[model samples]
Target: MKTRIKKMSDDLLWIFYPTLCAACDRPLLMGEECLCTFCKYYLPRTHFHLQSINPVAKHFWGKVPIQAATSYYYFSKGEKVQRLIHKLKYKDRKDVGMYIGQLMGSDMKDSPFPKPDIVVPVPLHEKKLKLRGYNQSDFIAEGFAKSMNAVFEPQMVYRNKETETQTRKHRFDRYMNMDNVFSINKELAASDKNILLIDDVITTGSTLISCAEALLEIPGTKLSIASIACA
Candidate 1:
């Protein structure tokens, strides 16, 4: 009876204010959550986790030692993936992060990727966190932790300084801006544990580099990175 009542309520709600897909903006069916089935099936998957020398992994070469790194989707200008990211970051859509993380988890489940003992998100600056009311990466980390059977440490590492925006900045400028911006708690990262550092996206990867540098200092901690997309 509860299920039937819910079905009726969903139908009525759809009639009054139908749901729409986050990526495609199509009207969602009653059972669809966050995105329509079609979007879920067709959203681009990078499959970088399946390979040994994926682009994401190579991006860190000579910079930081990482066991592996890959994004679930390829981000491009004027694309549905871009739209999804915009919603996740700027539009207060935490569900978009969780959905993408869950999709990403499916790839990690049986892949060559290293299993993580603790999942840590790239920390948001206190000012940015105040403006946004939540860290988008934490939402993604939560979903990934749920699927990967790992502990989620939302505050293990944090932004020590607020850096200037990376937008339209040169790679060197981005690097300088992010340098020493992140600091980690040594005791929390733990020794002899594999730590997966997660974020919403990777561009020049300066931000991740700063965070990884701090995380790697933890004795016996192995580091890997994952993101929702790579531009």
Candidate 2:
């Protein structure tokens, strides 16, 4: 009887304040976190975490020496993963990022990669952060930190200036734009720990490479990279 009452209370709250799926923009069913059931099953999973030479890792081949790199899902044009990312990035659906991060963290717990000493989210420019009211990647890192029982440093690296979107830029242009864009904070640098860098997505990987380069400048620091999705 108590469980039924709690269910009815939840239903009434939903009726008054419906929560929609980040991917499909439809009302989420009871117990659903972010995506609807169909969308969740249909999301393009990358399975890159199980592979050593996947596209995600290849993106940094010879550019940076990362211990490991992987993404949770594959991103394609007009796909559910793309839609989910768009909502998390532009529609203020930070819960989506956190949910995905938690799932990824669970998988990593069983993988061979050593648990990182610290987790750092790729930083957004202050102007963009102010406009968005939150850094989606930081929320993602928070989920990973909780599940992995590791320290989360949301401000380990910072964007020194606003950068143009890399979506339309060539590979070289993207690298040029991201070069030296991140600066490591001295407090974070002094730890000299193995770090897991977190981000929402990995496309050209310019951003992660840039952040990794900054961290590598610090003595005795090692880096790995993870993201919610990859393109």
On residues 124-187, what C-alpha lDDT tens digit does candidate 2 reach at each position? 9999999989999998998888789888899878999899989899999999999789897887
TM-score list, all predictions = 0.96, 0.91
- Model 2 worst lDDT window (10 residues): 184-193
| Global CA lDDT computed for model 2 | 0.87
List lDDT for all candidates, in order. 0.89, 0.87
What value of lDDT does candidate 1 attain over all alpha carbons? Answer: 0.89
Model 2: CA > 4 A from native:
1-7, 15-17
Give the Å error, residue 71, model 1: 0.7
Model 2 residue 132 CA deviation in Å? 1.8
TM-score of decoy 2: 0.91
Give one digit per residue, the lDDT tens place, for model 1 in 82-179. 99988999999999888777778877989999989999999999999999888999989988988898999998898999988899899989989888
TM-score of 1: 0.96
For model 1, give the RMSD to the true fold. 1.3
